[model samples]
Target: MVAAFNRFRLFHWLLAAFFLLAYLTGDGGELLHVWLGYGLIVLLALRVLLAPTKPRGFPSLAPARREWRKPTWAGVGKWLTFSTLVSVTLASVLGLGMVDNGEVVAAALPSVSIDVFGTRNWLGGLGDLENVHEFFANLALWMVGLHIAYILLFRSKSVMPMLRGLSPQGPGSAPKGRNHRQAPAWPALQVSSKVQETPDSCSFELTPPAGEAARFAGKPGQFLTLQVPCAEQPMARCYSLSRLPQPGQPLRITVKRVAGGRVSNWLVDNLQVGDSIQAMPPAGAFTLERTDADLLLLGAGSGITPLLAILQAALLHGEGQICLVYANRDEVSVIFAGELATLQQRYPQRLQVVHWLDRRDGQLNVPALVQAVQDWQQAECYICGPQPFSELAGQALADVAVPEQRIHRERYSGVEPAVAPPSPGRPSRVQVALNGQRHTLDVQPGEVLQDALDKAGLETPSACRSGVCAVCKCRVTVGSATMRSNQALSDRQVAQGWVLACQAEPDSAQLQVEY
Candidate 1:
């Protein structure tokens, strides 16, 4: 079902086939051999001349200076690739010079002859050139074999990109006007300030470089994806914005250390002021939907970060009353404690703040949550916390007969679970309408919908391939689908048929979707 064939891939396949055939038929002096040589010459020329015109077409055969110093596996691969290209080119040129018959392929085309070490005869004096050609040809073949083995053994995922001209987890170069949102550019934002909110938690203020603040502007409750440089590879982690968005102000994110959380621990213990980190633009569907509605916000532990932004935004822009139920293990574990107290004092009549410390009040269970929110049952509820607390709050709301559509929950984990590919079976049919084009795809059971579209060469916008970013959201128009996990979409959005493609799995045999 993977069908990402394109002109570049076609050229690559043809050139590979021609090179293999020509190498095998070396020195045959037959019409087929001569024609294959000519084909290789033409294909190689086209590839070299047209590479600059294609998107990221030029291969980085040579490693960068830093890469040479570091000597990573990537740099070694580049060296091997460069060696293969050089060997192939040299062999092809030698074969052209070794051609001695003018009428081998085309009578009108004159045969190419070179006097190497005073040689003119094909077998008598030019035997040395043939030996050299054979050396380079064999070297090219060996280099190619090594490259294939390296890919199969170490980077099996890379083969798909070569065959399809697109990476499985990367954004593709879709045609313009195709309704595909371009991938977010990761720009390095400097850390302007840092604050230790709690013993195991800290808040950092990140400011974009000069003239780029507008790109980071985001609605309250949205989150940013940070690319953390780990020891082995760069890790992408999502952190909710903890402060209200303002022009020319640095964005704020609170990080709470989680046991064995690599990114979180690194960020808390290592990140310093004046350092820079790459970040994607803010994205999430947890923003306040209606500022005018009475709001009941529920949060526990570090989950209060995003809810604080929402509460602040609501208090600043809306006339409706707002109440926040914040739970924590103890008084010292509360993040933004001072700020919340200050806001409560300033807006005493409009904002109600309730803090529940488990050390004093025990855990916030379903019965307790129901009792706490009984007075605010008519308010629109927004909950963000650990899975257990969020689920308990949701259950309490359901017990109170609050409409499901009015309750929204934001749930995410420090570590994402591994998603296995679907078991082999008959795939369901999916009819997708994107950018005025209709296409059909066969989706395997339990397969993520966004991945299916990617294999089919559709370049839909996506990031965080986990369901946290909501960058790959789409609407199902015909059949039904279920999400494996959802941290982005609100209950209202889900009810309205919006599904995050990265998390959606087909629930019916036939379905229709539009982006």
Candidate 2:
């Protein structure tokens, strides 16, 4: 689900740009070109604010032809979206250029200096809109017709509110402490305390918070962003889930400390078993195929967590042979060893485990890995671990001709990830609401919100200060900021415009965030 949202975000961005170009060249107001982006930017912002809530109603896929909150000019939103979609399509058909500048122009009139389809212009000496453009023009016309039909079909229902993001689905879908929309308090939820999974990894389970924000949603291979507050400041980080996401079960995370990592070192050295830590719900794209096909699990180091969850699920219910080949620097670095041993003991015939150490094996041999999986040509493979190693293992699978459909992956990290929110420019400050105290920060250029808080002598919860850890995750109830990187977020967040404060900077005059 998270992955789907992430993919949708990419499309929204591109579509937004396209809309801007189309509006600029149209016969409409020139400000439409620039202001449209801002309005849609706000629209994207609203998407986040509104997503947490369920849509009050649907647009009646059964097109209505009646009075449904008029789509006339006063209904700016519907008009903008409909107009943009239609105009772009028409421009595409008329072979109207969408890009500005030489040989390309959008906003007002498409570029027709050289028509792909030989057709005469119909409008004055300016000529026709272009023949190739006709295809898209007709397509747009059909969409508008359909939209109108749907509205008329559902006459009394308001389509505008739905499109504008105006609903919140209560219960079932709204789990505890999972909401990014809720105000941030010292997160009240606590998962099960750390459990030693293997010498290298420890698991932390959680008790999701209450209300519409609580998180009861997660799938195997998904990840969570953590917020760890310090007496003097807060930090954030993102971690992949080692335990699969179950409906009512506690959210579980298995973390492995790496050499020279500040947050990892802190987690291993300072964190207590009973102490509570706040976090965003499990979110990520990697996971195992929840099917009864032959399965292969691969990992180079800690990356084995998500793959383990996948394997565990399959073993408990799935009926298929599961083969796992894991490589590490040494025996000590192999995660979930005891669990694997136990699994092997229980399902001796159905599961296989192969361990390799760089020191003993003289680095991983691609030929050996390829040979190991040669028997399971139809198996689905889930892999995770070190970066270069993950890349190499993925490459090895591909070189050996593993089908793309069969591969999924995950990564573990202490450093801030690059996946931050899409925001405007550097901010001068941020308003933090917590403990009933409002703290204002004077931000420096290139500094994340975490840094500013630290400078203010206020401690907020956080993990990886760089942004990978969501420990410093905050809610922007008002105003906007940019994410340092977006790797840690699922598509749901990037669209709603939630950014990692540890990596984001403000754009508006004053910004407010809930931590």
Candidate 3:
């Protein structure tokens, strides 16, 4: 569900009411019909004119390319919306041209005359203007009827957004920071055990320090950001949890050594059992959206970490079929090969694992990927891998006509390029409102808003601080700010003053934000 502001809602209701009244008046009330048509034209013109300035108030009515490529009920609704807009505009224009005498409504308002194309003869035998006008009017009415039916049948939750300023099923409907509040800012956890999963990868079992077990809980597929103490400075890096999250069980994270990766190399070489490290609570948006639906899991190399978690959880709690397509360079580099084999043997009837080794199969191509998951095209799909592999899997799924909404992708690599560092200057002042409490602080140059709030003990919710996840979103209520990078926010959200606190930096002398 998507939320609509008050202005958009007003325009929506007024347009619907006026169109219905005008269509019903039909040849009986000429005066009322003409006036209603005039009102609609003005409303359409205003909507178009204000769209650039008020983006959130007037969403794009055009059907997206994906809607045309794939035929879903939601796509059909979008096409109907576009059709209705076109038909109504043509009807209004033809109606205006059909009006011959400039004095039709001049008696009521002597200063106004709406004779654009004067007489019906101006059409030059193309067709009767009144008939063409009536045809388009009826077509618009039909398209509107279909649109309403589509909403009531397939998108009932969408109606609330236009009726009120809130969407009952939207992500924003959840209480902000509720999940982050469950854990401390950074809790120390001791490594209980370590296992070499592959030649270059290892898994660590992290046990929460005494009295902090409850703060370490998380859903399957979530990740923990560990503060790695390198020689120069402590760097924060996120590692996916490798096993199902269960109470009283130690949290497990698998780290694969990457060439020139400082944090990954340090953890794989220097970290040992009994060593303690500061870790942020588990956070991510990659968790399963539905447990009952069959799942298609795709992964390559160490990207199998999160998918293993999801597969374990789904097999334990869900009664749905599962298919996993895992790719790796060869048998020696396949992480969790033994564990996957054991699980496949245990749940042979419900789970299927297909390993694609480049040594034998050559590189995984789009056609091969499509063939592997052809039977599960309708299942919920999750893809996690390097950027190239993820893109290939997504293209294969799209080729098979999977609905875009059902396919989720998580990139295991590619941190955005760093923004220019702030110049040396006096620190900026910041005022923050959180959970009904207010606090003031001075934010140093280049300091992120989320870091400042966390240092002040404000507990700002955040996941994927690079801006891929919008868990730390907040509104700028007073002054201006700029984001170093943003991949989660929509254009409408940006226009409405929403910013991702994890990437936001103060651009003025003073700034205020509410969470």
Candidate 4:
């Protein structure tokens, strides 16, 4: 029964992807016309055949805060999920009704009015059902508009894993530097040794199993979390996978020091041999969106993590025609410079590495960026950098005529917006659980949970304090906690009472949030 209900999730994502692609890049209207009708019948059939497995409860669509003290905001996510389901449901029902009357012939399906906008004349099987499908398709378009509108008003940086069919890390958790311990949910890449390659940069090679090379399983453009102990502060931080998913070979990540960052400073200054660290299984949606010969790899600061990984994967995968533009302040800050130079020397024909030095050249040369990507008209782009750098790269790609969708990006951490401190007058109480003990504190009303947790001298595990990452998720035992993250939670997870403590506040007096 549980498995059957899970199929709804699987089917929903697959169908959503299919329809999304169709609508975005195909003759979605006509396809949707037929697909909708089929979907309705399928939903019904599944309902009957998998009746025992269907969810017992239906979500309340009514815009009321009865269940929630604050309104459940369901702008784009709600609209997208609901509209896709509705569009497919309506079209499928109408199509089935027409098909049951022998109006649509399987043989005639191919020749039927495929262009929902092509011809009004619904010949043969397309008779009246075409009009009905058209209506639903238009309605679907409205839903799509509504979805976008909702996103515009209440857009979030973190997209939930459930909506996309993949479970992401939880949204919030303990503040920072609280002992967070979890064993390998997957075969973790063990660090054999942390060798000093250079004064500025170090090489972290994973310790393989049975003295074999350890290969991490993740996309070329995906990232993983590393948790090691530090004397000052100890918590895991996200690092881009710098190598493709190698089954048994060692995967590597290069890190440079950041001034005030606890983990970065610790790694560059105090890391040593025999010190093991905990790594969470891989997670992220910003994967190698796709591979194209005409590739543009951009990296600034540590944003180079995933881009370098993608480049390695491209080479290992036998990809050709690539150029990497690495921007840093100077040679002192250039990370993985040696490795990139070696790659350039080896694949001189297919790969080109351009180092943009802030000392010599002011910033990335706009014209050079344009020239680097001109060979392939239909090329895909992958970029990683700080917020400003990434935004600039996006604009540069657009200037070169690359479609918006073709340019993919990944960020381990980002610059946070200014957060106003919570008012001192109105303080609210929140309870957080660490290990097994629950600690409650009277937090300033609307004060960020992380801040409050810190004031109380409780160590909460965290990396990016921004609500985008799920380093702070805890299970809610008693009262509901509000999530301020842009990444919305799913109905099922919400019903299960999981909340991101970083983005949360105590909504109920007796609230309990636990890891």
Candidate 5:
């Protein structure tokens, strides 16, 4: 996601730089103008080749849009960008033609003789090439001015991406990890220990084998995507680290059986200590960082895992007024029940535990939860759980006028990617570039790029194939691919042609992606 933003920023600035230099230099700066001409031609060619894959940030030139009487601001901006690109390209071509005449540019700059192979065959050897070049060059200049003015008008919100290659999202949809792009590669680690938290719930502690424990540092509330061996194929599942990280601590993840969950069920029933599993380094953005604010952690089922970690970290730092509203089906189903009770007894003055049970409480209701927490609006609420539970909790907090920025959440799964419409039976030719090598593979129209890469014997780092982790994001340099959904990318990133390979499928016949 971020890669696309950087590409756009780089391409945009390069075009502007060349255009300005070429215009100021004119033929008087013959050598400068000549090189600028070459640069602009290359830049425009790349832009045009990649235009089809551009985001829907601007209005389409298609006849289909003619029927719509109203035009969007986005469409207007798109039209402006497209117009400038076209004008500049035409100007560059005309300039090259004028250069081929050699006599005109050479005369203007007496100090330098501009020499290049003459190709008068282009544009039917137009006699008014210089005039045509000047007209479009001036036209492009005006459009560039307008574009700069537009950017200035919305610089605070839009320009930051150009500078930092990042655009902020609403706090409700916080991106996963603290710049997870730099995270280490997945490492093979053996499970060191396992403990039964409750019936149907188990916690596995992973450590680097031998003296490699130094390689396994992780923060609380982060998660490791473990590659587990199944009977047929390997299954990847993300589980939150349930314990706070210490110098010598083993990374722990808690898993509870879900009725139809293949990964969770397999993990709870089959995973054992001493078994080996491949694990991506710990990464996630939903961790407790602000200690001054009163903390409220809301979670249900295994969602309590990360919240539990945050709670322990907060308590260790002596943060006061911390509250936990943990919900479950029954007391018997609660994970870490004993540890939570011990924590409550230890910090009876500052910590509060309110348990909601389906058997007695008839499901956790929003109004009741709000009522139970007297300082609900004052607390920074960290929530995790099933989709329905999270949605309910978020709405409840919002209903009470709690600031959206104060609420953080992590979803293990459930976001359907923003993908292309189904075109069943169609085949796509995908070219993948990874670690300086390129490979080609045929993907079914609806198949994700990662699957095709795997078939071609290439490894593309990924976690949470649903697109939340963003570890699989790759830049599409040619053709187009669409993500089914995205929580990782900013709008600017998507505009620049970044797609989550695990969640993206090609919409064009041939696509080129780089990792």
Candidate 6:
């Protein structure tokens, strides 16, 4: 699901190559030009189908908080991209029509008969069509030139993200220190044991047959993507490893029931010891590197799962002092409460556990937090929780003058997307291409892409409809669209023209999307 957006890199490159090839091999190189034109048409159609479902990345053109501020370059880029798509599409259509008129087709070459404009009256009746075709072809060339220049002038730095999927890690952007190998295939693992940590939370120990621990061995703070075979479709969910990996102990993951979570409740109610389930190797960015700096780990609810692993690993490695600020609804809801107490008892001088109960303590006081730890700003901080908890904790850390780079954060629930307002326009048509089939959807003035696609009966990959997951990402080949929010895609990914389909809305009269 996370990898869906990156898959378009090949298509993007191929489209550009084909466009250049077709342009370079004109009538003089009829065969080459003709073949390239056919390929370009197919590719352009695919792009049109993908436009409505484009992956929404971090928008460069987000609106300013103050309404008085002028529009951003991203706003201008939206129109420019749409114009480019329209012009290019026009050019491709005209070229195809001209070829079908038999002007460029040779007797010896294989040709497709698709004369939308009858060839019998080419010069007499089709003169206007030929002229319009030539005009759009020229306009497309100009648009392509301007588009390339715009990217070079303003978004030159984003070239790498277009080729690769990830944003470049600057210094101190959360330490992802573990060297990960290629992800192994999902293997069936038997549930060895289960321990109920709280009324709504439980820990499951899963082990593969003997000699499989090495494949499953993962760094602390990484998560497992579990495949649950539900009654409908197979569902996949990520869970953090709650314990540090050991030689003989099975891999353990903790799960807390979400209010209306289907997978979580199913796992808690249906999973039993000796039952086999599928799981992939661990993967995530919320990991702690072995450092000498004292650590301040903050967690709320089941967010403690990853932090617990980090704490145990740090203790085993003989790191500096560690302080944990764990928050829960009450004492009963605290996961790993006994384990945390045991660790604190064993490392009296090194570990400090501050358990805050929401029922009694209310919100964490920033000044009190600052005063609680000596040299608090100096310690490397890691925070995990639900979206609100993580944000509030991060803000508090900032108020205490902790370096922005020093504080790291992770969230168990997906974050909401951040989106710029739609470029001023009303789009009416949305076309989708999926699994070699094309479907057209009528989009209302304020309708989003996902809704239109749904109404049209095309179900694309999606989780966290808010755009935190890139599962519903598709490519925009024609027209223009805007996303409401996009937390999952990096700025570079946005620059490459990906938009999250779930949050997307057409910005032009017609849009095409391909997945």
TM-scores for the candidates: 0.61, 0.49, 0.56, 0.50, 0.55, 0.51
Candidate 1, residues 62-141, lDDT tens digits: the string is: 44444555666645666676677778777777866776544453354445433332433444455688788889988988
What residue pairs are clashing in model 5?
59-75, 177-284, 177-285, 417-484, 417-485, 418-483, 418-484, 418-485, 419-483, 419-484
The number of clashing residue pairs in each candidate reads 0, 92, 0, 18, 10, 18
Model 2 whole-model lDDT (C-alpha atoms): 0.60
Per-residue C-alpha lDDT of model 6 across residues 369-461, encoded as one tens digit per residue: 555544667777888898777777877788778876567776457332344444445557877877677888877766778777777666566
For model 3, name the residue pairs that clash: none
The most accurate candidate by TM-score is 1
Kindly indicate the candidate among 4 and 6 with the higher lDDT.
Answer: 6
CA shift of 331, model 5, Å: 0.8
Residues 224-266, candidate 4: write the lDDT tens digits: 5666576454465666666666776655666666556767667
**Best first by TM-score, ranked:** 1, 3, 5, 6, 4, 2
Which candidate do you rate higher for TM-score, 2 or 3? 3
The TM-score measured for candidate 1 stands at 0.61
Task: Give candidate 2 misplaced runs (Cα > 4 Å).
Answer: 1-186, 197-200, 209-214, 246-248, 417-486, 489-515
- What are the per-residue Cα lDDT tens digits for candidate 5 across 202-312? 999888666555545666787776766754866666788899877776788998887777777888788788887887666666767554346889899999999988998
Runs with alpha carbons beyond 4 Å of true place in candidate 3: 1-184, 414-417, 420-471, 475-499, 504-514
- Lowest lDDT sum, 10 consecutive residues, model 1, at 167-176
State how far residue 275 of model 2 sits from its true place (Å). 1.3
TM-score between model 6 and native: 0.51
